[model samples]
Target chain A: MTDLSGKRILVVEDEFLVALEAASMLAEVGATVVGPAYHPAPALQFAKTEALDAAVLDINLGTGTSESIADTLKSRGIPFIFATGYGQLAGVDPDAVVIDKPYSQAQIVAALRHVLA
Target chain B: MAVVPQKDETRALLGLTDRLYRAQGLDDVYAAALDAIAVMLDCARASILLFDDQGAMGFVAWRNLSDEYRSQVSGHSPWQRGETQAEPIFVRDVRDTGEPDWLKAALAREGIVALGFVPLMANGVVVGKFMTYFGDPHDFSAHHRELAVAIARQVGFSLERHAAEKARSEAVRDLKESGDRFRLMSEDAPIMIWIADSQGKCLHLNRMLRNFWGVPDEVGDFDFTSTLHDDDRAAVGAAMAAALRDRQSVTVKGRYRRSDGAWRVLETTARPNFSASGAFMGMIGVNVDITEREEADAHKQLLINELNHRVKNTLAVVQSVARQTFRRDGTGDLEVEAFQGRLAALAQAHNLLAAEAWQSASLEEVARRSLNGDADVRIAIRGPRVELRPKQAVTTAMALHELYTNAVKHGALRSSEGRVELSWLTAEAPRGSLVVRWLERSPQPILPPVRRGFGSTMIEQALGADLNAEVEMDFQRSGLVCTIVAQLADTVRQ
Candidate 1:
């Protein structure tokens, strides 16, 4: 149905609105949404348990730990995208797509397809 | 007519010549001259016209002439006379024949005839001429014309001298009035105003100076040098000598002993009064009693010294209090820092009070300085500048320090994401007293402590006891706001 159709997607963001928007965008592209984590704890848990999925990660969580989540996602076969308010993420995976905040639904889908491919 | 009254005319001419010399001024000269000529020749009306530097004769001084005749003479200038072919001779032809002028008609209504012009000569200058109109055309003899010219010469010189004397009188009168006003003003002045000769002896002193030194008239000569302080008399003497020698103003500060034997400091600035020839007449000086101002400065210095002593002692006491309070218990629980904080607040209050010389301190200045350690411009303001007295300053300084320390330890400014909004404003009406509000707003939620801490108690006591003002501190859902009502009457007293 779309460029990201039948693709598994993971979303990570500290703000609830951002996390919900990423999940919706993945669903719009006919991709199955995995996790939309509001904190680094849930995001890290999702990165370790979920298999073969593309992930979106928020670089700054209120708890100040997002690097560990990015590192965990890199160990898995999951391709990821980083959503950060501040510039340049620390310890991000080499293959991950870095998208700044306030992204459109189209951009999320396009980035998911690129990361999955 | 066979030249009747020749002897009567000779006597009249001699009388007219004397009247010319006795003329009071220009207007008098013109009137007497015209009157004398008219009476001698037996004419109806007479007028004299004097030309100015512009050779224009607009001035007409007349005698026995009606309003109509004077107006006709004034309306015409000397240029009109020059344009006419009529000479300095008599005009016996065409009397009132040319125009139906109102002047001619008015004169005819009164029955008048021939007019004659006699040139009034002074220093060979054609200054003006005289004219006489008779009711009937009559022949004028040579003696009658010669008398008119003689009257004109005497009147001209007398008029010039009269004008000069009149100007001199006005100048003298004005100078006398101005000098009298100056003397009256000096006597009424609040300061001791005096005039002294080169030897520092009194020539004149105003009423204030006499009252200030308590010198009585029975004391005979009011000696200005006697009132000078013993240690300063020689210096003042030497300075006056120097001023007279150099012809410059002299200034000195010395004590002048009052009649009650009380010595008062006087700052005297004297300038040598001189005449037009640069001769030194006397010395005029204004004496100001600066004793009160000097005393106030000395008091302020003492306050600063006391403040220094207290600060050093408080620091030493605080160090000992810290050691005692901290090590009182075997187990160290970081408990003594709480006590250390309160002592530091008191010390800081003293520091600000000393900085202002105990006159008054700026409320905003104390607030900003107290909060310096806590935030860097994180606080927003909402009030104009307010001045606080010494007592209010010390109390407010202590309270501000407490607020700053508390905010650093617990409030919004502690966190990087947090912000503070401070609003201080006085009430609309500033009559007998004023209401001041200090409001603090932050995003972080804070509730008023169940029991008031040392900071809150001190803030209440400081405002209430020291400032004699009411204080209200509230920790609301939005933020903490403290409002105070202080009477400006007590704070701004000097």
Candidate 2:
């Protein structure tokens, strides 16, 4: 029931296979993928400079937290959902939606739709 | 003939006896007895000598006698050893007595021409003798002899009473000094100290313990169980009681509440105190605060749990990668090999992360590890030292692997003479940006792939997206060239 056509979504994930699958899934929905930045530096850059409708962010990027990117997205009024293997992301915004790892494609698309709506 | 003592003399003798009985010490008794004897006998000097352990008489008390005379004539008693019930010896004139010449000279030097030695009998034994010396020679009277005998008896009774009193007081003083020292030591000790009676009743608490419990200094006979944690009070109390009953030592750990309502872990060790006769006296205990040590141990356990959780999550990520890799069209055994290669790359990154406590890894290390199986003669790696965060390290490792696999299959590593040049450097202009390039060279004509496969897709799309870098892949006639430029400002240490 959700239409992602023409929408540009940023995907920030560290794991290569996960990032590729997420990009492929967004492309399947006719949505344009802006990026799948692996680390916090480039993820923040894309969040600040890119034309994004929504975003999927992994809370932990292996070395440190991706909290700065989440803050940038929040400041720009861009809707996003956290993609993490962890159950709880300490210090994150309480109202932000989180999708756990090994998540199905449908779960991500549904979360993105809910936030974008 | 001598007449008996008048009524006044009888009254004075009774008063002297009363005073002797009331004397508090040996000196007081000796003074009173000497005064009474001097007045009754009307003598110039008096002295009391007691037999020492060697049966030699030593002067115990004297009145108006020269020290030299007392010392020289101390052992010159008229009676032999253990000679009790003997009549008093009255020397009307020492010049005519058949005593030793030195004894006569010593007595004469002190102007004593007459003397009387009356034995002091106590419990029908002559423990000592008292002497009365007259300055002028005079004939003895029967009444005077009776007076000497009576005075010596009173002196013997008084000496015994005074000696008993002296011994009792010395014992009392020693007991008090020992108690004071015990209290002082316990009060100044850093740890809490306490004492309980044989019946398990609290008898004493040191100043430190009193302050800890917020109790007064004089507070004793209070139940210590009230200050213990509710859950541990019963057990600790039972253990202490059992130890007391057995007259043995006990060691226990429990939580006790402080005055400010904070609970602290305390380790108590108690041992039984005993008297010289081996009677069970009481229990003495010491309590040490161990709260901080317990907290530190708990914190270490939490860190270990977190590490185990992270390891499990890493394995899950590996599983997901395998699933996605095999879920493609035309996938076969080759896909398995490629998948295993990628998994190995991930594991290498993990090893580097683990070595650094999962903080970060080095860029040159990641690249070198990914090229592990490649022929060393055909590959050259040149780079400045650069460290990457854990996420960057894993992504870069996988990207490097894809490049290496491609070079082996169709590029520089496909032939023995072929060579691959891999190098990287940091850019200061953009401040913390890194550029890494891979160039392959061979004699065979190089050709570009007709369509993008998983390898190329990962090298260009996955690496670029994950690293947030600029990826450039050019299929030149010379060979396959790949350039990756990423800012390490946020990912790497300066």
Candidate 3:
């Protein structure tokens, strides 16, 4: 682990439990967890106001609208990783770290470290 | 019967015998002549056997026995040509006859024969054999027997008259059976068949008509118009009425109430039956039961519609999965198979869904699709009707298929000793939604995978998003427990 403590991490997940898990992971390393929003509008709004060190986005937002939030995060020079069921976001964000669905704690941490490095 | 011949009636030249011969046709001539000869001979039976050019003798009439015996004994009498006899040859005890095989066999089969073969000659030329049979063995009387020879002379005078009448009657009977042949074939056919006169009054009905309608045999005597169902009777009656009024043909498929009180579907074709005189008499038709075939056709159409819906949903899933999966690295047979495997899983799920007519599938069905294994599967589906949309059905099918494939690659189900127990339960959610748990359990030891693959992502994320459920899988040291909170309202389309 790269000791992502004190890092302000923005969580953008549609599922409450998954959001809890992401926030728990960031909190374990002493970082701040900003969001577990089901829809993209609140997530994008939260990203605009909050100082985000990084972001975790659930690829399937309500009404398939995750990219608008992804664009918002990119504008702020924040790094993000996509957690998705369908592997359908190739051309949209090829450079971002992608954590496939059903990720283990170790794999999620390792992938985030690579993205932040 | 004793005959008293009057001397005075005899004095009138046999009482207008000349006038009787002139007025009576030749058949009456043979009858009158044979009666007069019977009186002189005092024989019990006297018959005329006219010989044809083929030399076969035929009994034309009889005086002693009734017409019945005469017909039986003298049927196409077998007298050959060149067997000329100046005197009558008496056949006594003909039952013990010599075998030209047919002659002796025929006599033995009939059980009686006492023939008197009398050949009539004209100017030393043999014309035909005049034959008679006696009921008892009696010597021919000199005066009476001489009268039989004279009777034979009168037959020669009227042989042509007898032959022409016999041929005419035979031709009429042949034509009648020919007409009835068509009637017999259509009536006996398995399909319901019947005929009605131009008035639409049923005239003939075959056994099939009664059988298909479950009617008794006597139903043929009743009117067919009475048996039709109430809704169909009016239209069927109208078509029949139009056909009869126009003297044209009619074909109809209608419902009729059977004798068992069930309505049956019958397809009928009716055409005008005309007489030899060209008079339109009736119509004949056949009806067949098409109920089973119609039901099969309807089921097939529903399947086609269901298939179209599945295709559209599967394409959407593929479009999303392909774009995301290929984003990382879009090359190789491995990725393609992975993609195709997802689609195939979806297809297999659809197959099961289609089997159930798009109704809710058991968790076992989903599990069976998800895993590839040599293990026995036990399914426990406990819930109300949770009918899946085409999208839901496909996604579930594919997820299970991928799970099964992974299991086959590495799990308890991969070995012969293992079995998978797939169970589902619906629990009340906090927001009034429903939580459904799909748990795959086994007796063998297991461990969670070090790395989650594409299969895991599809099952955990895609299905979660679509179903609005949180899926948690804990790979226990003993087995696996996947707790899924599924909102019923999210899974089912409104």
Candidate 4:
């Protein structure tokens, strides 16, 4: 396993339990887990102010999409990946890595490595 | 003196022939006949009569006869209709013997003492008669009788020709009228209508079709395929060509550019046209605009996609909750992993169902996915193509997951040399019954567990209840063998 120690990763998800699960998974991988933001508002705020190595975003956040956070992360020259449950990717940057919902730990880790590389 | 009169009659007959030939109508022919009769027969008055539809004679053309005198003599016939080869009659004097006194009185009142009746022949049958009236008593010689017959022949031939011409012209007029009516109806129709020639060149386009293509209302061949969308052009052309080659009916759908620069989906149904004598004339087609219907279908597909996305997200949330509730410390890690594996198998089944819009899924796919680790090397899957309903597929997938994990932990898969074989097939005896077998073998003997666990319970109890299946799990020293048998209903077998 690749060590991500001291690397800060932000987890943004609408579902509380899902967000907490993703955060703990990142912490187990030796990375510093940032805000497990449950909505687009805090997710956007954290995206605008936080210094991050990478971001894992859920494309749909109940009220609206997390596209604004993705856009801010792009402007800040940060790499990110969109994890969605829609079966297919749509209306997003073509370069962004997309993973389906209920992703395994190995899939998430591999995707993080590819985006950060 | 006899030869001089005979020459005059011959000349008169020739002159009559010229006039009859140039006559424009039946009325002109009747006039010529009346004039020839008066001149050649040496009579001051003559009248032409023909048979009406009721078989009675009526005066059609006359000269120098009073209306009362003509009406009194009407219906006078010396020969019946359809009597062939009849000779003309000579009533040298109406005042002679063997005559009714009333007819004699009427003839005398009009100052007619002599009359000659000549029969007109058509198609070798008597059709009508012509009469000559003289003011004084006279005798008709053989020359006078022969002259009258010649004149009757000319008039008979002309009447027969006129009848034939009239029937022909009426048929032509009726045909033209029907054609005009068809054009009027086609132009006013709501759908686009077109007619093509045998060579596939469009010969006619109704008003709706012309407006659809923004073409002028002129009679010229138009290439209807020019306005078809690029992607649909080749396909539509090929279909039409095939239909034309075989002279068959065809239906094709494509996108066409309308006059307003918008694309509209159109479905055209066309049939081959034939003439009365069974000759291939061309094709006639009707086009219906279906853009609205196609758009509605696409919108429905989008809605189904959104719904599937929501369901997957809910499944993801459930997985997260299960993980949070189960402690991840060493003692509880195995339980958490087991729960997650079961959830993943269910999600995999859901994915398969969703791909097919939740209709059905194949058994081979469920087995391949559930037998996850070293499946290609250590396991053999053999089955005919079998399909199951949504509920049956989910249960079957869960059962396979349990069986696979159990073999890996405590069954045949725990030994390096162990192998597994799975097979399924349908039966005809029970009318669509299904049978599946799973056999595991290892060099080391396997033992039956003392206590049942969740995996065995799921495979044996839940699966059996959900599918109405009869399942048997046999633990032997050499391996473990599991068999399941179930009936497939017609509604769920796909």
Scored by lDDT, the top model is: 4
* lDDT of model 4, residue B143: 78
Report how far off residue B316 is in candidate 4 (Å).
2.1
Per-residue lDDT, model 4, residue A33, is 86
Q: After superposition, how far is residue B309 of candidate 1 from its true place, in Å?
A: 2.4
Tens digits of per-residue lDDT for model 1, A44-70? 888888764677776667677578876
Q: Output the better candidate (2/4) by DockQ.
A: 4
TM-score for each model: 0.43, 0.37, 0.29, 0.60
Q: After superposition, how far is residue B377 of candidate 2 from its true place, in Å?
A: 81
Score residue A28 of candidate 4 by CA lDDT: 78
CAPRI verdict (incorrect, acceptable, medium, high) for model 1: incorrect
Instruction: Give the per-residue lDDT digits (tens) of candidate 3, residues B26-130.
Output: 567666656655555455566666556666667666665555455445545344545455566667666555736655555445443566666655434455655
Give the alpha carbon lDDT tens digit for every residue of B127-209 in model 4. Answer: 88888888877788777788888888898888887877888899879877886777788998998998888887887789998
lDDT of candidate model 2 versus the reference: 0.79
Off by more than 4 A, model 2: A1-117, B1-17, B36-45, B50-93, B109-114, B118-128, B134-157, B160-180, B183-190, B195-226, B230-254, B265-283, B289-494
Native contact fraction (fnat) of model 4: 0.57
- Name the regions of candidate 3 deviating beyond 4 angstroms: A1-117, B1-337, B353-385, B427-445, B490-494
Give one digit per residue, the lDDT tens place, for model 1 in B439-481: 5555778666576687787677877786667888777765567
**Residue B122 in candidate 3 has what lDDT?**
44
lDDT of 4: 0.83
Using DockQ, rank the candidates from best to worst: 4, 2, 3, 1
